[model samples]
Target: MPAQNPTGLPFDDIRHLVATMPAADQAAGDMARARQGDLLKPPGALGRLEEIAIHLATWQGKGMPSADRPMVAVFAATHGIADRGVSPYPGAVTKQMVGAFTDGKAAVNQICSAFDAGLRVFDLALDLPTPDITQDAALDERACAATIAFGMQAIAGGADVLALGEMGIGNTTIAAALCHALYGGEAEDWVGAGTGSTGEVLDRKIAAVKEAIAFHGAALSDPLEALRRVGGREVAAIAGAILAARHERVPVILDGYVVTAAAAVLHAMDASALDHCLAGHVSAEKAHGRLLEKLKLKPVLDLGMRLGEGSGAAVALGVVKAAVACHRGMGTFSEAGVSDKA
Candidate 1:
């Protein structure tokens, strides 16, 4: 893994960038719609496939969209909350899985290889975990913003589309707290059996989330504050990567539950900030579908997957490529010498 470029920005700068995100290229989207109609298929016959093509066109600012350089950027980090018996696995598993990714043995690696997509793994100071959200702020304002700046580096490999995923033991607890803070739901609505927690372990996870939110209190009123207070390093980085993709006109595919928490932070800042992203899948994580619905993103797949390493997003990338291939490779009715019904 190449060293991440050094970047240290403040929250104000991140907020400003989010506030002024570029709108999608509507002209290109219109042209893509027209092109779809010209293809040898009935209008809307392809369903979400047609919509996906237009989505890429609009975000990529090109009528003929390309997924030739799809990339998956997976961020891995440790959470101090793991000390609270929130996750069945210890926090050390975060580092171990990151090694598997580097050795090309992880599920996401296989998925990216299957789709012919490039893969990048970011280890965000796995040795130095964020503070336990139930005990203290996960990160101060400066550290949170800096982590985001580092996350923006995921865009440097010239990928046209980015799929965001994360690995952090106990992060489900972190995400639950984030969602409860952002959406004002009871902690149970946001908590789930992450890492297969159940019985007493699940109860601790729920209590941890409720305690963290109550402790954070008025600080969570601002979205960024909410992120820094309860979010982990990988969460902040994913948020940065999504924002960078939007600025670069690169469409994004968001992976399951943990990844969506990052997007929720930005969406809280600006409702349209995630206009360039698509939900890669709805995971088996119980709250993932609820989170996706709140974000207004219809997923590309729903295979009961809960392994988080951007694997689902990588699989969804294949679907996106299929949509692009069908839209651009199929012959128009005129070229195919097909007759039209009056």
Candidate 2:
């Protein structure tokens, strides 16, 4: 295809970013919460979410965590596993729906606008035109390099927080295949209804995932190869982007099942990959919970959102923003003129 924007940053650049910046130490959060407890409020009146916000603030290395310019990056591409008839919607929907998103007609568009979050779309390997479309799949060296480069550009272009969502009809098939390869289990474990399908369709989808895993077994021993084999262009791209975000010190907000699956694969490759990730929600998918457990992340929401277009992440945007606000907005007991006595 045509040349997209300059490929992602070099591997060394990514490495440098990671080395220079790391997640804030948990000790700091513990200390901050201890201070909060001694404050005038009844112990834990602000609740668990407030503690979560404080923890995130400490991670961000700021008294207040403000994702003032949060940006949403949606990767759209086709999945080879879809050829086995995994999704109810035609694979063509991947390309078409991308158009809807770009034109600002999709539900994601509305949410992004409502929250003032910048929206950036990528075509890792789709047939249509997007703001950025790279030539490599997640498994290819060029693609991985390009994904890192594009992600860096997104970060530099003013995205403080990054949200990842995918838009390929049969991406769940690719997700199931990747999960099986990385976590070493059955595709049926992670496979579930993607883009709204019937029970029979879901079964066919699961079988396709299994078949793809078997067909690509040898290549999948390598993390990148598994991505190349049955993974969708967007899924791999998201993984690369998440890694880049970590290097750049930008927090990554993860969406539902598909994005979680990608995050799991990234974490499997590099345990530190989870450092900057904020789990958006626990999707309704059966394996989503398992994936979260594997990553040791507690989601911010569980609104029963099953939409694949980053809807879960978008919904969680308010809380993340609020957390940042709380860190900065809330007054210390001294500032509020309250006694610090037990």
Candidate 3:
């Protein structure tokens, strides 16, 4: 493939970027592991917290990981499939919710405040929705690649960790369609009644995903093509953000089905592409757990959270904080004058 897409965005650049991403620091992870055993606690006493600290240390390339500058980035876009009534909320709600995030009125806002994480909400051409997937590709190759480039800038301001969340009404349908195309199952396997769609609306949602797969055909075999066809702008942006995070050695916390769809595209290309990401939660939205299985990622929480907007990711940030505090703040058995088993 050429290094550039039709719009002059470098598709080859994306491919090379994912392929050449930095590997985790094995030395740092080993050091962190040694410290975990030295901490004044019984073996495995801290469970996932111990593991979480090692994951951060490995990716951050430090013996002690820092959750001090955790940041939550929310990408908001409008999906053309939303016009099909796949979600109960109107398409305009995508923009409205972005406003709510900036105004500190959204559920994620309270969670971010609680966690003391910086919050940044990005609006990706909400006024110009992507083409409806059932009838046409969601975006042209150039537009898709450009949106991805824009997403790569998400972490430019820098944070030690990145938690991704998205808001795009009817995006659950887009997410389902992307999954069906990428993973190949019954459309119903990936479909979910997002925002309370059920009965007739749910049927329409499934049907739309089926139509999109049929329409895209062989093109879906290529992850980038699948992304440009059925995926939304936020999906493209999220993929870019994930790549950017990997290149910069920032661990990612992914929220909900839509955000995972973005990661799926990268994972399809390189299985290790999402190695830095942690599934923040198993969403109440159906098929989410199934998708996580496909990614081989164990989520950090399972609170039945179906609300999008980085809410789940924000909640998991608190867990990450606990892990960091335990890993870095505690004294080793020797330093604390505690005895270790011989």
Instruction: Please give, for residues 251-274, the per-residue lDDT of candidate 2 as tens digits.
Output: 778998888887776676667768
Clashing pairs in 1: none
Q: Rank the candidates by lDDT, best first.
A: 1, 3, 2
Ranking of all predicted structures according to TM-score, beginning with the best and ending with the worst: 3, 1, 2
| Clash count per candidate | 0, 2, 0
**TM-score for each predicted model, relative to the true structure:** 0.96, 0.84, 0.97
Q: Model 1: what TM-score?
A: 0.96
The true-versus-predicted C-alpha distance at residue 76 of model 1, in Å, is: 0.5
Stretches off by above 4 angstroms in model 1 are 1-9
> What TM-score does prediction 2 earn?
0.84
Give the Å shift of residue 111 in candidate 1.
0.6
> Where does the lowest 10-residue lDDT sum fall in candidate 1?
1-10
- Give lDDT tens digits, candidate 1, residues 228-309: 9999999999999998898889999999999999999999999999999999999999999999989898999999999989
C-alpha lDDT values of all predictions:
0.92, 0.70, 0.91
